[model samples]
Target: MKETAQKYKRQTASRYLPVGAQEITSKIMEAESYGVSTKHDGHFYLLSYDGKKATLTNHGGRVIDDLPLLKEATALLKGKCKTVVLAGELYLHKEGGRTRSFDMTAALDDKSTNIYFAAFDLLSLDGEQVSLDIKALDQKLNTVLSSGKSLHAVKNSFVESRKDIAALYKEIVEDDGQEGIVVRSHNGPTYKIKPLITLDAVILGYAEGQGSRAGMLKEVLVGLCVAKDEYILLTKVGNGYSEEERKNLLKELGKKKVDSGYIEVSGSNVAFTMVAPNQVVEFSCLDVFGENSKGVISKMCLSYKDGTYTANGKQPMASVISPVYVKMRTDKKPDTNDAGLSQITKIISLDINASEKLDVKKSEIVSREVYVKISKGAKMVRKFMVWKTNKEATGEYPAYVYHYTDFSAGRSEMLKKEIKVSDSKKQIEEIFAAEVLENVKKGWEKVKS
Candidate 1:
């Protein structure tokens, strides 16, 4: 079951609109027919009925057996001759009003009753694998799964030209308030068509690379300037950089390194090297959400001056989805107008949490430790500190932070640091212990705090 779930995760599609809608339309005109469907903002899960029971598993291989809708699915699929597997989205479907992706996220977190499953693909039927075309898959799904109160087929249609696609986009995305639409080519690649939201942001830092990209740029951290020297943490862009661009951009950004008082890490677990906010870059995203999938507010404000970046407070900001690096804007300065926060706010209405506030208090240091190691008359120093941000009530900053700083005068990049934030004391203790075990070597002597 795990292998099956891994083999066919959600089908990711390439974007077509905002950049090359016409070029994509020209390419699609060559194909015979394409299947287009409204893209629902929801979580992807695989539903399976193996004769005796129906199991619903997410992309992470964790089975969600407690969903009340599972009982209805089991009742409908038990009569099938073989084990049936279907791929669909679990979304919030209100009977009378419009529901967005964030609503679905909140619903899932609170176990809301409005959640519904919209089946899109038919992976298996009668215990046999199905490799049908787009139209055939739609037909098979309609024939296999009946529309119930908790389950229904996703809205889809067939298109052979650009006009059809544009009409669907106008009706579904622009008029109907959907996030976007997905079109599957008859026998070729699939494309996701959505109006791209563009923003000019300042480059804040870059996370170190890994694997094949070692010593190169893995991700670029960006921010929106809300005022003359104030910025908000926007997102960590990891895509749209060519292999050559990665090496070249990294070298260019290396000269602007600064000792920013805050730390941010990438999904790959590499620490970011802070840089001066002097460069303006363009980025495009499909959409932005104020809350993450886990129902946590995702907003952080910062103050920058004199080659230093400090956290100001947690304010209202949107977390971008699939942020793609466009280019470096050499003509524009990294100021409020060029990299303004209103660029995003004017386009989409951010769902601001009532509890979110800009109430940042002074961070209190709970513990401090310093260690010294001298070799060949060169002194190397390590400092570890544990502090409470006191802004945890805002749901933006972590309750506790474990910071490790290393300064070696012998190295080219003389100073390196790592920061770990958590809400649990046990986890912080484990992190502090791990750092001590690894860095406190034979020559290192502890200094009184």
Candidate 2:
């Protein structure tokens, strides 16, 4: 295990600048098995399925002029991961009269020019050569690159015609982080390179269809973000999300009241409108058609960024009560859609989940308050209570018991008759208290009998 990248190493001192056209460096590099795909319909690294060795084509490559950085960039590979070649731009930094890669005026002395590795296909693995067709290799990228980093899949197909690609390209350049969108054909092989893209878009409104959208609105509202404003109804998305997801989403939107009229399907506008523009959902779509959304929408899918986790975390309190809006939507004379109990659950689920999460074991409670009273020298202070079988006439109805107890001799006295009531708790306690006061009893013993 000697500390050297290649079993063999050699570099010529002849200097060449990278600012030359795409082909000269590519031709020279390809001659040395460095530059990639000969065809430049679109730029990509032609790689075997395994990453043991790769060829970099000069589609958008401009950093390859320096020969030393190219050799140094080649050295940046990790030998243990996959035994395949990689192709990418070898960027350098220029400092103190020397041109280098990927540096500010500083770090020129250290001499670090690393390769920005952009892999396309799996060339070989476990000594198994990548003899698979481009279609199978694309499927492999989805499997391997689904989680960790593998190869970047090149765009080769289109759902939209050429018009869509130009519009999307403009949007991609505008978005600060987006590399740009790619429109590819479903049947086109991965190596078919040319892809058409439509304009990038931002969501403005979502449609939940009437009668069924405790299911879904059947369509969603989409638009483009211009310099400051979001354009109207470029398209509507209904392709993504599951049945449960659609239901959950409608439940969320119904809770929120939109202040403005949402861009909607022209003839199919239901009672729904603007909602809180708090969520930014992203979709990779292939086409942009129609002035406003038709009743129908396109077929590409999208994944919501927030997912269920958005509802699970510390959710923002509603800016206003939604029942008024709910009533407005439901009670409108023209709108026959009456939302049912199952349709609205915001105020209920939160309380239920909170109770469950905070559940505590409950047991019988003992009274802890201390009571103090003067002992009567006469004998007792009787108490009496009268109750009615009638549940409606319940207000202080026990006051009639005073008519039965005697206090005529200027002292608390006896019961007019024996008080009894099918072992009623309040009535029994009253009878015992009255008996005690007529004689003498205190504390628990006073109430026990």
Candidate 3:
């Protein structure tokens, strides 16, 4: 049997680099000139027209026949082209004019919602691949596209300098609903840069891997603790961990095994072996947004009220855009790290003062001043500040002493002692020693047996 015309594959952008101002500038400079387009947070699918009918296939070349969007795309593209393959993003727009990946998943079942295929490239025409220059190909795709509401040619621009690329990226992220930008060169590479939010979440368990990762840890199940012994499973992060990190994590997970428990994830009966929940991992993703779909929203442990959504009344838990595990935070404790769902939501929403430069400077200053002392028989550190009491006293000046149990967890506050000029050296030492012991005890209690 001859293969159907619907079965077509196209090359995609696979080279992913860290999305940052510096990295983007370097990539753009290497190319010397590149085209910048909005990287919509949606699936990449190919809309193919075989002279008569239109077919939609995902980036992986798998046919997607059930989506209402695909059905609509078929009707819209019918007879529009002789034989053409258009590459584009399949996305669903939210109420605030933002497009989300989860919204695309939710819109699959909703026939009323209009799905958009934002075409950016023309892979083939009339059953033959287009071998024209980049600029010519773009122009050809624009001319062939019909006046359809569902399909659109993605807006993009060509720039020669790094400053223009940086400015364009900033404008896209800030003013254009936080959607990322993709910089593509004529005969070079494609790089994507997006506004990413990082957070620390507790690892619950691991899911079994398939293919080459079989018998190894494939995905780590992570969540945020809303209350004592209560948590909401946020996402199953599969990307970002290195091979060494994966092997090390598997060994570590072996040491902290617990009973398998039921966790609710959308459209799956996934069981996880509960761990100590003491291990914290850092993750970075696009952003969090609310979902109005009942089927999609029901899977998440979020509450909706008065046209607003929150996770445990503390953070927004609509859905994390595209979460990727950055690293296993060995220095962080689940209870102490406040980079949970709610905290991340606040930072992303700009409710709390969030600045990359300021945060880095603050962290550097804190690391320099705060000294950590490991407690006896614990994987915990006790931080303390030592200073002089007075000139008359044999010791240092401002007799104020502040001690902390765990710096990353920020559990115990600084035990301060008001210094007086009349206070003796012995009195200051005694006060400091007493506070140190108390902080040490508090730190030990937080460690899981």
Best by lDDT, which number? 1
- Against the true structure, what is each candidate's TM-score? 0.55, 0.22, 0.49
Each prediction's number of clashing residue pairs: 0, 44, 5
Give a tens-digit lDDT track for model 2, residues 364-446: 21111112234353333233444332321322112212112323233433212222332254654565456545544354222
lDDT of 3 by residue, 1-449 (tens): 00222233222433334356556655454665677887776766677777656767763335765655556666766666667788777777555676766555446667435777888778777777777655666677667765656676777788887678888987877777656788777677677777777878888767555578655667787777655554556777878877877777776786665542122221122334446677788888765544222211222233323323233322234456568888878788676345354654443221122211111111011111233444453234444443442222312122332223344333343232211121345654565566556555432432221
Better of 2 and 3 by TM-score: 3
Candidate 1, lDDT over the whole model: 0.75
lDDT of 1 at 401: 85
- Badly placed stretches (over 4 Å) of model 3 are 1-11, 16-18, 59-80, 94-96, 203-275, 279-449
List lDDT for all candidates, in order: 0.75, 0.31, 0.56
Q: Per-residue alpha-carbon lDDT of model 1 for 1-449, expressed as tens digits?
A: 65565556523311232223333456454578888888776666778888877778865567876677878878877774468888877888876555455565457667666788888877778777889888888887877776566876776799888678878878887888777787777877677666777789999988768777787888889998878888888898888888888898999998888876666666775457888999998888866655332333456777888879887666667776678888889999888888887676555445444323467678899778899999887899999888887877766567788889999999888887777777787887788888888988898999997
The reply for model 1, stretches above 4 Å from the true place, is: 1-192, 195-197, 260-265, 269-271, 288-298, 349-356, 359-367
Pairs of residues at least 3 apart in sequence or in different chains that clash in candidate 3:
311-315, 315-342, 388-396, 388-397, 389-396
Clashes of 2: 44
